[model samples]
Target chain A: MLDVFADYMTYQVFEITKGSKLGDAVNFFIYDSLKIFIMLAIIIFFVSIIRTYFPPERTKQLLSHKREFLGNILAALLGIVTPFCSCSAVPVFIGFVESGVPLGVTFSFLISSPMVNEVALVLLWGMFGWKIAMIYISTGVLVAIISGYIIGKFKLEHLVEEYVYQMKVGQNEIESMTVAARLQYAKDYTKEILRKVWLYVVIAISLGGFIHGYAPQDFLADYAGKDNLFAVPLAVLVGVPLYSNAAGVIPIVYALMEKGMSMGTVLAFMMSVTALSLPEMIILRNVLKPKLIAIFVSILVVAITLTGYMFNIVL
Target chain B: MMKIEILGMGCQKCSTLLETTKQAAEELGINAEFVKVENIKEIMKYGVMSTPALVVDGVVKVSGKVPNKEEIKALLNS
Candidate 1:
């Protein structure tokens, strides 16, 4: 139905020639925008409802006292449902720590929360197939787990700011909502996220359409193609400093992939952009010492770089 | 007299909650003392991990979201 509408708009309403590049790009833009918006709304709404069940307070209770490897895994999984923002990281970190949740486990939750979120998953599914989306999610969770476990093993407790340990966190009652309230919260949350991301989505899709219509075939293949040993690391390096939401970056990912960038390299780039952001690191610096922060970034960079290479070889 | 505390580290939602809560207080004609809790330690004392949280008379009424005016009014009345 959407395809038919896109075709009608492009050919009948706009009157660009049926097979012209402009018509093709316009058609691609319209179809993709409609499809992505629909997917984002439905997924975000359901995810928000799920989130209402897993606030950071409850997540802390779940993670506290669990052993390291298992805790890392659980934390990474919970990170997907837990409602966390970088701005609140300090309090969450302190809360988790004071409640006896291991540092590594806390790190796992932090890493996966931003990286393997519903928005990124939905966007990847919309653009790429489910197979690629699954690959992105699994690898993202693995990186979070492995990096957090390694940090945990290092026993970098002293590296945390002294105040984080000294501070006592009070326990408050978790809010309970009725079914109607949950539904309302979900509705409001979906609207809030869509309002925040729609502009980025439109801009990304437009840029992708332009690239699809105009960029030369195999333009990026020579430099960042599968054969390039350095391509994965290079993509991660570039992506880490360049901060953008998943919505803002997916169109560029589409453009790059269309230009023959390898799947692994592209996925790595997206993960770096979302997961290991500089601003998030800055926020974390409030509690983590400079050394701990450096170690955290380096571990993730290496892990992501490896994941990129593994994907390049496997798929 | 009621004391209402908005707990957050100065994020946009924190301010939004503050404004809505203030408006609700006026609408309900309740004499309330409003405190904006920006200190992380002070916020932690309330045991609220997420913000902006609404504290009515030292008890947490809500956290992690900006409730609407009607909801805030309900919280105030309660």
Candidate 2:
């Protein structure tokens, strides 16, 4: 279905330019935009439906009584399905902590929820193939678990606000949802995500289209190639300030890869953009002290940078 | 006469609870005073950290999740 649309778009664009470079760019833009938007809508709808089952209440229950390493693993995995709204992060953090979910376990969920979410998976799978998608999810979860475990070892419970401990919230009740309500929530969630991301997707894809048509393949490789040891960290630094969803970022990744950027550098950049963005830090700062937030960001940067270097070496 | 207070910072779930509570009250044919507590300080005064809490009169009946409409109806009736 999409292939036909892409071909037709390409034909239309090429007809005007008679196979010129501008035609190629326009063709690439149309094909990519159509393919990505369709995939994003379908995947986000289905994923939102699945998300209805894994709200913060349910996630708190799942991690409330589990042991450390096991809890971290479970939390990280659960984070993938659970829909995370940053506005609720504070309340959920308090809820989890009050319910006896170890602070570290909560961190794992917090980390993975945004980083290893279905949005990232759908975008990566659509553009980069299943292998990269699978790798990204696994590695993201692994980082979450490991970071949570390490934070657990540090006994940073003191870093959380003192009010959280004193806040005497009652035992939360998880209510069953009707099928209609679930579908409504799914539809709303899909619309919300699409609305927030559509403009970014268009811009990213257009930039990618331009790059694919005009830039020399060796341009980025000369500076950010695997041979450059600093490339991974630099990518992480550059990505942190750019607040974008996976759908928005994947176009850049696609363009970079086509221009000979290493898989490791690209993956590192993607993780940094999604996980360590400045906005996320500001949101989390409401519940966490500056010291703890610093530790969290440092750990994520280190983990992502290491992952990038390792992948570059191996692949 | 009954007072239904829904506590939260007015996120999506809180709005849903508000709607559900209104529907339940209407179906039960009860003239109830419904209040939405959106201020974080006000919510904290209830000793509830988790959002979308339902308070019946002065007592908190539910916290941290949206109760189904049937459950809300039951709470209203009780």
Candidate 3:
């Protein structure tokens, strides 16, 4: 049905030739925009409802005092369901620490929460096939667990700021809600997320449409192709400094993949941009010492780069 | 008289919560003292991991989201 509408809008309403580049771009944009918005609305609403059940406070309680490896695994998995925002990172970090959640476990949650988010998953599944999406999810969680475990093994607790250890966090009751309230919250949260991301999604898809129509085939293959050894690391390096939500980045990833950028390199780039950003580094610096931050970044960069290379070889 | 404390680390939602809570208090004709707790240490003292938490008379009423005006009014009344 959407394909028909896009065909009609491109061929009949616009009067562009059926096989023209402009027609192709416009058709791609219209179809993708409609499909993405629908997917985003439904996915975000359900994800928001699930989020209400796993507040950070409850997650803190669950993970506190667990052994390191198991805690890291649980934290990484729970990171997907827990509601988190960078703005709340400090309080959450402190809360985790004060509550005796292992630093490594906390890092696992931090790493996976932003990297394996619903928006990224939805966008990847929509743009790419479910197989690729599943690959991204599994690899993302693996990176989080391994990187966090490595950090824990390093025993870098002393690298945290002194104040984070000294701070005494009081306990507050989790807010309870009725079914109607949960539904309402989901509705409101979905609207809020859509309002925030719709513009970025449109802009990204527009750029993607342009690339899809105009960019010559195999343009990026030579530079960032599967055989290029530096491609994955370079992509991660470039992605870390730039901050963008998954909605804004996935369209570009689609365009890049279409233009012959290797799948692993593009995926790594997307993960780097979403998971390890300069602004988040600055925010984390408040709690983590410079040395710890550097180590964390290095570990993630290595882990993401390895995942990229692994995908390149396997897929 | 009521004391309403908005706990956050100065994020956008924190200010929005403050504005909505103040409006709710005014609509209810309740004399309220509003405090914006922006310090991380201060916010941690409340034990709320998520921000934009509403506290009435030092009791945490809500955390992690900005309730609508009607919801805020209900909270204030309660």
Comparing to the true complex, what docking class would candidate 1 get? medium
lDDT of 2 at A195: 87
Candidate 1 lDDT, A1-315, residue by residue in tens: 999999999999999999988898999999999999999999999999998888898899999989999999999999887877777888899999999999999999989988888888888898887899888888899999999999999999999999988997887987687999899989999998899888878877787777655778799999999999999999999988776767778878988998999999999999999887788888788899999999998999999999999999999
Tens digits of per-residue lDDT, candidate 3, A1-315, equal: 999999999999999999887898899999988998999899999988998888899999999999998999999999887887888888889999999999999999999988897888777877787788889988898888999999999999999999998998887877687999889989998898889888878877787767654768899999989999999999999999888777778667877898899999999999899888888889899899999999999999999999999989998
Once fitted onto the true fold, the runs of candidate 2 whose alpha carbons sit more than 4 angstroms away are: A9-23, A251-260, B1-78
Name the better of 2 and 3 by DockQ: 3
Q: Cα RMSD for candidate 1?
A: 2.0
Candidates ranked, most accurate by DockQ first? 3, 1, 2
Clashing pairs in 3: none
**Candidate topping DockQ:** 3
Q: In angstroms, how far off is A228's CA in candidate 3?
A: 2.0
Better of 1 and 2 by TM-score: 1
Error of 2 at A208 (Å): 2.9
- Each candidate: RMSD to true structure? 2.0, 5.0, 2.1
Residue pairs with colliding backbones in model 2 are: none
